[model samples]
Target: MLLSLRGVSKSFGAVHALQDVDLDVLAGKVTALVGDNGAGKSTLVKTVAGTWQPTSGEIFWKDQRTSIRTPRDADALGIATVYQDLALCDNLDIVQNMFLGHERLRFRLLDENAMERAARGTLAELSVTTVRSVRQLVASLSGGQRQSVAVARAVMRDAQLVIMDEPTAALGVSQTAQVLALIRTLADRGIGVLLISHNLNDVFSVADRIAVLYLGRLVHSGDVAGYTPQRVVEIITTGTLATAAT
Candidate 1:
């Protein structure tokens, strides 16, 4: 496993956001994290991303036991989380946005040439072909194009594990398809992808593994071929289904 949470739990005073949850994300594969509202999906993702430290748990990266105490710690481990908003600057162009805070510098100034070349290379690596140029402003890009840029930024930073939250939530059919293909391309490049999504179609479309969280606990985790949409819905609502493999 590339990343795994063992007996993980998080609490806000008396409210237990996650309880004894365990999940594994393997390299070169997409693991879908799914659940209903308040089902601990966000909490788990935040915990793994180091935004929120687990109240009690162990985070294993690359099979060694470790701790994610902060976002920087997670980044040091090559883990990047791309939320639904994408957290992009609308005024910035693609190259600038890709190297926003971590800009390359040859002397005391920004290395525009190197940054542009690297951004273009990362986008090409992801097979992104929508944008006309890397100099285009982010605000002018489409939803899928913006998403592709956000993901490409992560790849540019050499993120080994990319955890995306609802990457295609607001996209149209074609845009959604585009993002899904890009996700598959990411896994094809041997990156571990943990996709948190509410849409089952999107999940089944790109995920190799599925891990279901229900009310602060993991109810199921297995291959995508093992569960149908109806079965997934059943587990999400009731915490269990007759066909659930546990």
Candidate 2:
């Protein structure tokens, strides 16, 4: 397993966001995390991203018990999160956005050629071909292209596990397909992808595994073949498979 959560729990005063949640994400596969609103999906992501610490329980990275005390810690562990907001600057070009914080500097000067080459290389490796030029400002790109840039930036950072939150939200059919293909490409390249989405069609089409969350608990987790769309919906709403199975 690339990442594992054991008996992970989170509480806010009298409310519990997660309860003894145990889950595993394997390398080179996409695990789709499905849930209704307030199902502790965000809480779980935040905990793993180090935005908030778990109230209890343990997190394991590559079988080593670890504590992700901050976002930097998560990044150091080769974990990258791409939230709904792409977090890209509109004024910046692709190379700048990809190397924003970690720029290539040589002899106290910005090595623009090096950064540009690396950015283009990463995008090409990911099979992203829609953008006119890496020099194009982010504000001019389509929604899907912008998403591609964000994902490419994560890839360029050498992230082993990428946590994507609602990556296909607000995209058109073609754009969704494009992003889905990119996701598959990520898994093909031996990177673990934790995809959090409400779209069952997307999940069934792209995910190798499915984990359903209800009332802050992971009700079911197994191979994608083991779950039907109806069963997933039932679990998300009712937190049980008895009726759906029957």
Candidate 2 segments exceeding 4 Å error: 244-246
Q: Give one digit per residue, the lDDT tens place, for model 2 in 154-233.
A: 99999999999999998999999999999999999999999999999999999999999898898889999987898898
lDDT of 1 by residue, 87-123 (tens): 9999999999999999999997999999999999899
* Weakest lDDT window of 10 consecutive positions for candidate 2: 237-246
TM per candidate comes to: 0.98, 0.98
- Predicted structure with the largest TM-score when compared to the true one: 2
- Clashing residue pairs in candidate 1 are none
Candidate 2 yields a Cα-based lDDT of: 0.95
Model 2 clash pairs? none
Residue 209 Cα positional deviation in candidate 1, in Å, after optimal superposition? 0.2
